[model samples]
Target: MNSANLNIRTDKDVKEQAEQIFAELGLNMTIAINLFLRTAIRKRGIPFDLLLDAPNETTIAAMEEGKRLLNDPAAPKFSDMEDLKAALDS
Candidate 1:
């Protein structure tokens, strides 16, 4: 099959990072872009989910609680796995 050039402009850092990742996975930019395009055509949409990973309020509260517990002087500390198990059982 005859091949054609596909030109796309992206940030220098983004291009470098993506190229590095593709190289590690035994792919180059052309192969990676073609794979993406072919997959998108086959799936009729983006092949991967595009979701914001922002933490929810409940998750944020839990993380804050964990930080507080870590800093608390009275928080119980276990020296070993057996001690932790014994504390949990009590």
Candidate 2:
């Protein structure tokens, strides 16, 4: 099969970040881009969702609080469902 060079203009940091992500997924940029192109052709559209529904402020705060509680030694731990319910009731 014949191959072609595809040149693209992208921000250095963005390219580096993309490379890191692709590497983590066991793919190089060429394979990742080719997969994307083939998938796009098969789907007749972009292969992934473009609309990103990021966590709202309330959700972010709750997640941060959950993490803090997880790391806290003083955070209560219940041995079972009844114990958990008892703690909640107290």
Candidate 3:
């Protein structure tokens, strides 16, 4: 069987990070890429789950609210468990 060259363009940092991870997993870049391709072929799609890792709208709003409360001088603060429980029960 004959092998052909496959060239891919990627960011330098991305390549370096991938190389480091592959090295830790006992694979070179070439072998790691080949494994990915083979798995894709066998699975009829990409071998891993693709996800959007950014915070959702609700999470973003909650984070913003938390930041606002953290900066507000009038925000409630609990010094101990009893104080926290009393505040919650009110």
Q: Model 1: per-residue lDDT, tens digit, 1-90?
A: 999998899999999999999999999999999999999999999999999899999999999998998899899878899999999999
Query: Candidate 1 — which pairs collide?
Result: none
Write the number of the candidate with greater TM-score, choosing between 2 and 3.
Answer: 3
Give candidate 1 regions above 4 Å deviation: 57-90
Descending-lDDT candidate ranking: 1, 3, 2
The ten-residue window of minimal lDDT in model 2 covers 76-85
Off by over 4 Å in 3: 54-90
TM-score of candidate 1 on Cα atoms, chains taken together: 0.58
TM-score of 3: 0.58
lDDT of 1: 0.96
Error of 1 at 28 (Å): 0.4
lDDT, candidates in the order shown? 0.96, 0.94, 0.95
By lDDT, the best candidate is 1
